[model samples]
Target: MDIQKSKQLPKILIITTGGTITMTPDSTGGVVPTLTGNDLVRSVPDIAKYCECEVISFVSKPGASLNWVDLLGLAKLLNEKLADDSIHGAIVVQGTDTIEETAFIFDLLIQSDKPLVVTGAMRSAMMLSADGPANLLAAVIIASSNMQSQGTLVALNNEFHAARYVQKSHTGHLHAFSSPACGPLGCVLEDKICQFVKIERKSPLAMPKNEIASVGIIKAALADDDRLLKNIPALGYQGIVIEAMGAGHLPAHYAPYISEFSNKFPVVLASRVPSGPIFTHSYNFAGSEMDSIRRGAIPSGLLGSVKSRLLLTILLSLNYSPEQIKTEFHERTEY
Candidate 1:
């Protein structure tokens, strides 16, 4: 397919990282990412009409396999490209498994006010009803449009969600990504971009200079053992987020170990249940939310465990003290 050269159209960069969106069936009956960025661009010829697109084949791995180092490298590359006066915005195509985390990390690290949109498909590109092309087209449109909003966003299923609130709610549905508490920032209607909410952009955090901090997450279960908690610091983790039971309660027997762990490193408590803030005063049991807070554990109000872990990792990488980390969490999660 040939794209007509036009000076009036905005230039957008499509950075392809492997996901179901770029996958094809292998001989083993499993899907593998075999499409390059140019292949994706060629598949959706209509996107050429909206923007002067350029393709960059960044990596070819599932999103779930990506780690903090990968995200940091992507963010740095984006910063360099978006700084160019000719490039208007960028679109990241990756696997949906970790879109929420990757997008949030990008939102935190990127300093550009230009739109950054992330999109992926639930089905492989070779599937009967593959959603990659349409999603990529929509993402390119959003990235090139003068949508007043600034920061990283997820554009999927014709809807745009702020990276801070978007989550993967379903496993196989086309409309898997959703903003549970804040709803979507906008939608694409009749090929026109429309934004309903105007979010205030926060100052970007300084990218970590050292290797990204090691952070781990643990979900509290019925009759959970506390040995994991006791060994977290010894295992070389700088921080950890605990997904506790309702309102952030652990097994009563784990209270002492929780206290012991918090004393060694930053410990954040988030609710295992989706879509709610952690309660601080509701319960007074031996291993309750309040009890954890009193033991120097920070509460992740409305943030999920995954996000909480990201925040803690960033803060620890920046060398924030435990007290300072608690203060930052209060400022961020209080809303």
Candidate 2:
């Protein structure tokens, strides 16, 4: 695992937040997913050959257990890394279950031209011919490449995806990550770089200084009742993203509540269906997407509920007016 250590190798800060890539087998034959930051480095020895990798160990919680508190902590820390010029790029190794949500949130909060790539292994390190090391090595390479200044990206199974569109497609497989409605921005080849997309950097948005204690996600259902919606505002939620039906239609029961909350804080509407972005007013309900738009509910075109929630939190933190939020969301898209 020893390779020449040169200062010229790109400095990559590998943030370990725990996922299958760090997991190993326990005594009972079941996979035991417990690994610290150093353990992750030891397991993936190839990283040493790639760059000046610094392992930042956060709580090694499985991705499913990552809460909003963990997300905020990660975002704040990444923002700190962004300010460090010596750190050329950053990498977050996490489980796939909630990786997209975390990555999407980081994308909105931290504006870094340095490649901030997040990756995770679909297979365990203990498995025969595991994929963890390969994915980890590939991510570091992408982060250190000439395209480092591009916006936040996620690399898994050799594919490079923008934070906005990547999703986990299977529980256990090498090719589990997909962009769904859009193809990857690029791909990684051995010792070479390939980019198929371009991103224009806008003025960096500062992280909000609001006193947001917590935030959570809610998805729209077939007959979603207003019980949850009725309590969310009073529960002191700074924001909520609704996984609305096709083209962002909520259950008829939610229309009144949607109208009610659109005035209070940021309420974003995304699609439950996976492939396309959530459009406004695809259906002709009385309080349809058009009505919601008039009332100031944000339409998350193409961004799913998780990503929408992430962006909405940022917009809310920035104290963006409803009109400003809508325009910014639309402007940030490369789809």
Candidate 3:
């Protein structure tokens, strides 16, 4: 831990994992994880203007490569460090690919209301107009400010999004991350944290004794036979999230598969589309939302496939029964 030069600055912990924010081009022209937490802290020249920062170079891996073990370890870090009264907040810097997922996971796992902001860059550090430093500075500002218990948040492009609602809309756009279902909670302007909305986070979950539980997702595409659906249980998956067409519909032929999965595992019916609630009563076709429910599928309201899979995985890891899992999903899906 770096000793603070001044006693008055808000103390923020800037934990770094691997992402574009920490990467530079290699000899082969590919970007790789290269920067440490202290390195990132130095790259942002104006960050000191916002807060007194400490760096934890946690891990250096692409967001897509991170597993439950790494993720749970991150949660443990945040929960432990934030328990300190002097620490104002934590800023998690990593790759953009899985920020939405990790942010939501942290939102559920972190017990404290202290501001926890996850930020990353779309462009590599060597690229012209790299956004990492600016984003990091913004994250520092947000971490130092009063968030008033808004759950975990994604701070990028000067905007702060609620973790539950944020997603990576574009693969490489500077403004790639957004909360389509609900807009950002706020943004940073002129080194100040601006406030707009407040999200009532659900009760924090316990760190699972079992770090992982097998879960799978199958998105319903055009003419998708969903042939892979039957293999979930045989492959030892404890939970299945069907990314059904529309609100919650597979092809009419998928009825048997849905029934089979529901009978064997906790099946969550989530929507493939973004930005809308999973409709439960709007449709009544053979494989519609209500029909799926009639066939014993649990509806994931508002939660899309990715978040649904993460939630199911966490619940299963906690050893929740099918009925208990259904109740939890129902509760989380609504709010």
Better of 1 and 3 by lDDT: 1
Which digits, one per residue and each the tens of the lDDT, describe model 1 over residues 113-158? 8889999999998899899998988898899899634679999999
Per-model tally of clashing residue pairs:
0, 3, 0
Candidate 1 residue runs with Cα over 4 Å from true position: 1-4
Residue-wise lDDT of candidate 2 within 54-159, one digit each (tens)?
A: 7788878788998767877888898888779888888898988887777777777786777888898888888888888888888878887777556678888788
What TM-score do all the candidates reach, one by one?
0.95, 0.87, 0.97
lDDT of 3 by residue, 1-335 (tens): 46365778899988988998889888999999998888878776677776788789999999889888899999998999999998899999999999999999998889999999999999988899999999988888888887748889899999999998999999888989888777988888877877788878888888898758888888888887555765666788888888887778788987877788788888889888876887788888888888889888999988888999999999888988888898888888794
TM-score of 2: 0.87
What's the candidate order when arranged by decreasing TM-score?
3, 1, 2
**Model 3: worst 10 consecutive residues (lDDT sum):** 224-233
Rate residue 82 of model 1 by lDDT: 87
Clashing pairs in 2: 113-149, 277-302, 278-302
- Clashing residue pairs found in predicted model 3: none
- Model 1 clash pairs are none
Of models 2 and 3, which has the larger TM-score?
A: 3
lDDT of 1: 0.87
